[model samples]
Every structure is written in structure tokens, then in C-alpha cells.
Target chain A: MNKKNNLLQCPNPQTECKECPIRKMALFRDVPEDDLGWMQEFRNSQYLLPAREILFRQGETAHTLYTLFDGWLIIFKILDNGKRQILRFLLPGDFFGFQVNSIGPTGGYLHSSLALMDSTLCAFPTTQLRLMMEKQPQLAIRLAEMEMHDMNLCQHHLIGTGRKNAQERIAFLLLELFHRVRLQKQNDYDESSNSIIFPLTQEDIGDAVGLTSAHVNRTLREMEKKGWTQCQGKYLTIRNEEALSKTGQFDPRIIISKPLI
Target chain B: MNKKNNLLQCPNPQTECKECPIRKMALFRDVPEDDLGWMQEFRNSQYLLPAREILFRQGETAHTLYTLFDGWLIIFKILDNGKRQILRFLLPGDFFGFQVNSIGPTGGYLHSSLALMDSTLCAFPTTQLRLMMEKQPQLAIRLAEMEMHDMNLCQHHLIGTGRKNAQERIAFLLLELFHRVRLQKQNDYDESSNSIIFPLTQEDIGDAVGLTSAHVNRTLREMEKKGWTQCQGKYLTIRNEEALSKTGQFDPRIIISKPLI
Candidate 1:
């Protein structure tokens, strides 16, 4: 089933090569055939390494735009004192490293993005990507919209940083990620209850929510004591889903639905 | 020569009729003849209002969209507790009521767009507006972009509200208004550095910045003392523009340049 040696089979089962693999990874449905060919050419790319393996360091020239086929990636920035503050996490179908369009790296560096697991990604060459985008403007438009979407996600996450307390923000984040991962795993998982199964490390979750690792532990324990939620390693059981959302003042619509405008 | 009654003449003495009486507005240049005819009809058919007249209330359903010809307009929103927040102040060539294809009202209501002086505006019936837009899809697309731009402005303003401390935010706002007014006045002002004229109350400035009037006064005084900017009534002077921007951590590139996606 596997034509390439380094990469895994593209999660698509019982399908003809004509039907091909990526029917779901968001932009796959939107990107046209020739562009898709370019994406596939980009896919025969280098092997994606494990967590903490840096994609490209901040201040380094951004050379590749990743089409995330599998697993999790975190975008972060390193402060002057060399402490890392994680800014955001991308899901299965999301792309990253798009501040590449600017004239220069004005925001110092993009810190570093690392795969939380051994994820497979299609890496498009920046120059080719631009040319292909010019040839196919819809992809470019979608890319712009997607970038705007991520910026909105960051703004939403900033509420956790500025407005909400540590506990509330964590709940809100878990719920938000649950919806995204749910969309991906919908065909595979049971839809009756808590079918979404993206397990996140407490450390990573803390980073995404802008809290200290210790604070993450303390907040989870507090929520568990209150029977708001149950945590077992990376796995969480939503004891009272509605109550959890309320604590976060979480509007599912913000993360789930497209902007009405 | 004044055309039909109710339509205001461009204050500038040198303009011929075919040149649209004023050269500053870009809306009519590329538009089709039919659309222009519709617009001219809308202009002649609409009513005129005197200076400082309230056009509509905040949350009021805007059945009419106003195409400004002459005089200034104030767009402000009244909050839940009846506090007014100024979203923007517009000169000639601005339009209000984004409810063209949209059924009924949108989220933010149409506020009382008062004329700072005796003003003329063209009003199109919503049904006719839809017909006009269907014929000119490009204009519709431009409208989308304009709406998006305004939304971007609002998002940045929200960023100021959520992220910035009062002083930096206020300074940033003053600089922005000065820059915009300067651009607007370059068309008509032959004399007076005080061409940044719009008699907007200090209270209006406070509303936009989410500050109390007293707080706005204090911030303005501090700005004056530091020589970052100056304000005398509606007249504003930007002495050190670069430093004011730095105070807000403002990246003008994001504001000025279109994203090359």
C-alpha cells in the first residue's frame, strides 16, 4: 500500500489511488489539481521529527510552509531572557510559518515550532508556493482567510491570558481543541458522547493556556475536586460539560462556527 | 451651478460638474453608468438635514444607506448603560448602513450619524441597492474589503482595549486620527496647519478610547508635556510621530500595507 519508504500511508483506507488519500485535511478539498500536484511534490518532502525537534528557529529565514497532515505543532516565541512562551498550537489540518510573506522578520523571531509527535507534513518551498499561489489565487485567498482564522484564534486565546483566570482558560481551551480534533476524528470515533480523542500533555496544555506547569496541575486538581472535569494523564472526562463551558464563559460558536460577517 | 435642491455643492470653487464637483472621492470613477444613474436618482430623491441633526439612533434599524456628499458625520454607538462610544467620524465620500443584501439589521445598530455641518447624502432603497450590486459584483467585492478593513480597525481597537494600558492606547489613537485627518485635508487646505478640523468633543475621544472624560484630559496633558502630540479643540499636532507609535507597539506596516498572501 505504501509507495514511499519514509512516510506512512495517508490514513485513508479502502480507497483507490484515483480516489487518492487527503479528502479531509481542510484545504485539500479546496486546492485544485495542479496545485495539489505541487502539494504532493512538496509532500515527498523530508521526514518530520519528534517533539522538541525544531522546524525553523525564530530569526532564521522561513523557507517552508507546512501543510499539516498529522499530529500537533506548537508556535512559540522566546523572550529576551531566553524563556520560551508558547503562543499557539495547530491541529491536524492547519498550516504554519506564513509570516513568511512580509519583507523582513519584524517580530524578531518566530521562536520555534515543534511537532508534539512524529507528524507527517507536506513542506512547500516558499518561492514555488508564491508562484503556485499566483497561478491559483483561490488557494492564496484561502491561505489569507486561514491566516486570519489563526489570528482570530490567537485573539481568542488572549482572552485566557488577559481576562480569564487560569482555571477558566484551561477549560475553554480543552473545549475548543475538542471541537477541532472532533471534526477530524468524527468518522472514526463514536459520536454519542465524548468521542473526540486528542490527548494533550499537561505541560503543553499549560503553555497553550499561558499558565505555569505547576499552575496547570493545581488548576486541573481543583477542577477535578469540584467534579467539573476528570483528568487521567492526557485523557479528560467531561463530568459536566455545560458547567465546564460556563466556568470558561466559553462560547462554542467562536471556535466552531465561521464569523457571521 | 447647484443641480437639484437637497444636493449640497462641493465647497471647493474650481471643480467642473463632470469632475463630480470634488476630485477626492473614488467611489464613482470606475462604476458603470447605470449604477451612477441610480446613485444620482437616489441623491435627488433623498431628503436634506441641517447641521448637528441626529440621523438615527444606536440599535435603530437603518432602512437607508447614506452616501455622503458634503459635511461631516459622526458614527457612535450607545452602550447598554446608555454611554455613547464613537466608532468613527467621517468626512465626505463615506457611506453608512452596511445592510445592503443583509436582511433587516446587523449586530451593531445604526447610530445617529449627525451632520457636523449642513450635509447632503444619497439614499438608495435596499431592494434597488441589491439590484445595483448584482450588476456590479466588483463593487460588492470592494464593499466586502471595506467592511473587512473596518473590522480590522475594530479588531486593532479591541486589541488596544484588551492589551494596552490607557496612556499608550490614547497616544496611539491621537496619532492615528491626526494622520487620517491630514490625509483628508491635503485636498482642500491651502492655509492653516490647523486643517485637521472636525470639532469632535474631547468626550468623543474618551468614548473611542474607553476612557472617562477626565482620564482623556489627563492623558492629553501628559502627551502635551512629553511633546509626543498636541491637541487644541479638534486641532491635533503630531510632533514626534515615531515615538508615539512605539508607545503603542504599533506596527504601521500592518495598517498601511496589504498582505501579500
Candidate 2:
């Protein structure tokens, strides 16, 4: 008898996780009965960090895979001149820090990940996680699919940096965040909404979009003036999602999805 | 027996393709026998054109997947301000033009791709491809994987736009292109005294790296002066691949791959 709650036991410090509340998460949902029980044994809760709190830093060895239970996190990269680019917004049920040795040695660093909002997640050892992947091709395939989606988001950022003006770039980022976060759980947007609680600062947005902080500020003001979005510090609301997307030049169909692991 | 040469079926009026030397590259390489025969029936060559030829106009329905067989192609996006941003370079045997159904209708005019050098390819119809994908999970999975790689390249472009300096960006792109092209076949550099015969115009390279043609020209001269590369018109012969990579701030491990399809 494998219940969602069955006295989780593991040696790792983050092994306290068992009965997570996030329902939309597709990871491990399709695991067979016996494997699900086995997975529950390897789970744990490492720590909960609030917005701007660092979970890991660049050049740090990744020791565990994190499955977000709640809250938001931003993964990003920083330049030598101290500029930073927010890569993506990680939400509940999103898994990070996982690797597949079958591919090659994992090299990319966790450049920027701080809580965008207070967040919780289950952490599992990378080696053990690999065992699960090797045992379950579906899991490995799912991870690859997730990476594909992450890549699509980055592709859009390339457009923003290489071409779109600051205003258009910022508008697109907000719209993307809103739509992505909405899927984890209904917060403020539908399939497409510009209104979502994004944790990135204007400076962060500027860096990702290849603009200055002052430019980001000016763009936000302009967007508000145009009635495309309502910005209140870190909190934002989109007045017209359609109009907002045009600003970012984002393609909605790029959200190619596969069966979640 | 399955072969990769069946990409030469006649379709469009541009059917002056029968005698083309690079007849439908070896795409069905290692494809299972059953799948190869089916793919052959859908292959079309008349739909293809020489380098700089429009495969499909921007915003045009992404009706076919173009697989490079004999030359190089540039995948790029045009901005509202009429500036064209070269996203990345696609090589022979590479696949692009995969679109998710729900994403915006990207057909006929949003972005345009032209051959950087005279090239050949096989085009697969969108309708037949989709139907085949629905039936072949592996093909869909392979397409998704390619999309992931293309997206990674996009992330690299974003870095070029947002983080790296102009020199670093140029160096990075050079090292990347060298590694990619070399992996498949030796470029001009290898065939003649370790000099790469990079045949891209400064304007094209500028569009790719988000630099003005003048700036790109200046940068090329600077690289020549620094002994980092030898650029005489469109022919670039890398002085030292390893030393050049150092200038690009590249960790060869990042560019390392096992020839994924």
C-alpha cells in the first residue's frame, strides 16, 4: 500500500518531502506503482528561500535536482561587467539541476536562481536521479522535452537582444512569464495574460533584453501610458494580452509541449 | 534497402533539380527501413533553391522542413525597425522549420532565410510531415531534439546580445562555426594550409552577430591584425583553431557533441 503520505525515510537532509500539494506537476505522475513508492523514499525538503535569496551560485557543483513545490525562481547569467540576464522563470512542479550522463558531462552552471517569491521544493541527489532516468526512459525523455521548452524561451530572448527595442522586449517578457506561471496554477492570467507576479527587477529585465536599467524603466512607463499594461513595482497586470504579445513579438505556438514526466 | 538519396522527387516548378550534385542529402541516415521508404515518398527537391534563395518567406506557413545537404544557410529573424538579426548558422544535414500547431501562424513573412553559400536540401511537406509525426513518435521526438539544439544556439545568441562584448561575441561565433563545420567536413581553412575559406560576406556575418557591416568589417580587420584570423573578402582562414578559440572565450567542452541527428 503506497499512500501519498507514508512516512518518508531517507538519509539526505532534504528527504522530508512526501505529500506535496502542487497538483498540476507532471513529473513522476506516470511512474508505476512500485517505482512511485521507490521515488517517495528518495525525496526530501532542503530549504525554502524567499525572493532574491540565492539557492545556488555560479560555479557551484550541482548536488541535487529541485522540484519546486510552490513559489517562483529565476535562472539567469551574469556578465563580467556585472550585468545579468534572467534566463527563465521556474515555477511549481518544474524540475532543475537534473543531468543525464548518457549525454555527456553536465557543464552549464546555475548562474542565477533566487526565489522570485517564497518557494518550496523537493530535492533529490543527482546520482540517484540518474538511476531513475536510466530505469525510466520516459523520465529521461520528459526532461529532454522540458529542456526543449526552455530553449524556445531563450530563442525569443535572442530576438529581444538582437533586434526588439527595450519597450517591446519588456512587454514580451511579462507576457511570457504570465502565461508560463498561469499553467502551474491559476494565479492572475489565462493562457495568455500580461498580469503576473514576476520577481525580476527592471535592471534584470534590461540586462536580459540588452538594455540599460533606465531604458527598462522608461519602457515600462511608456507601456503603462499606452494602456498595454499596468505596472506596480514588481506586480504587473496586463490590460491587453494580445497587444502585449505583439510588443514582445513572441510566438505563442512555440510552447511545444510533451507529456510531462 | 534504405538510402539517403531519395530526397530528389520532383514537386515545384523550380524542378531544375534533377541533375543537382547534392541531390537530397543523406537525411534518412540510419533510419529504420520501414520509415525510410515512407519518408522517400514525401521528399521533394523542386521546392528547394540555391543559396540566398527564399525557402519560405517570413510569416509564410512553415510548410516544409529544410535539411541542409551541400552548403550553409543562415536562420534569422527581421525586427519591426527593418533590422535583420541573424539568429544562427545552419549547416548541411541540419533540420529547421518545425512549428508547434498552437504557436502563432508563422507563415510567408515573419522571417526570411537565405543561403549564405550555394546549398542544396530536401523539403518535406508540412501536412504529410505532421501526419507522419503523429504516427512516428520517434520522428516527432527527433524533431523536438533538433529544436532543442537550435534553441541552445539561440541562447548563445542571446548571450552575444546581452552579455558578451563585440570581440568576445565574434570570437565565440567563429570558434562555434569552425567547430560545427569542421565536424562534418573540412572547410577552406583545412584544405589549404590550415586556412578556413569562410565564404560569408561581412554584411551577412553582421546580421548574424548583430553588428553593422562596417563594424563587422572593422572587427575582421582587427582580428587579422591580431593574427586571430585571416579574412580576405568572404574567405576566412582561421590562423589557429585552438588559439582562436581562446580568443573567443570558449570551453571546447561546451561545443562538444556526438553528432546528433
Computed on C-alphas against the true complex, the DockQ of each candidate is 0.09, 0.28
Per-residue lDDT of B135 in model 2 = 51
TM-score of chain B as predicted in candidate 1:
0.77
lDDT of 2 by residue, B94-202 (tens): 7665542112234343455667666667676756755565455455445544554555556666767777767777888887776776656543334445444476787
- The prediction achieving the highest TM-score against the true structure is 2
TM-score of the A chain in candidate 1: the value is 0.82
Question: Lowest lDDT 10-mer window, candidate 1 chain A?
Answer: A100-109
Where does the lowest 10-residue lDDT sum fall in candidate 2 chain B?
A: B1-10
- Once model 2 is optimally superposed onto the true structure by TM-score, how far is the C-alpha of residue A148 displaced, in angstroms? 3.2
Q: What TM-score would every model get versus the actual structure? A: 0.61, 0.76
Assess the local accuracy of residue B237 in candidate 2 as a C-alpha lDDT between 0 and 100.
Answer: 70
Candidate 2 chain A has its poorest 10 consecutive residues by lDDT at: A1-10
- Return the DockQ of model 2: 0.28
Local error of candidate 2 at residue B227 (angstroms): 3.1
Which interface RMSD values do the candidates have, in the order shown? 7.2, 5.3
Question: For model 2, how does the per-residue alpha-carbon lDDT over A1-261 read when each residue is reduced to its tens digit?
Answer: 111221123335543223444533546654565566677777654456656667766665566677777788777666666667666667877777533211223543436467767777677766575566556645545554566556556666777776666777787888777666666555533655445676777777776678888888888888888888887776778797788887677656554354321
Candidate 2 residue B231 Cα shift, in angstroms, is 2.4
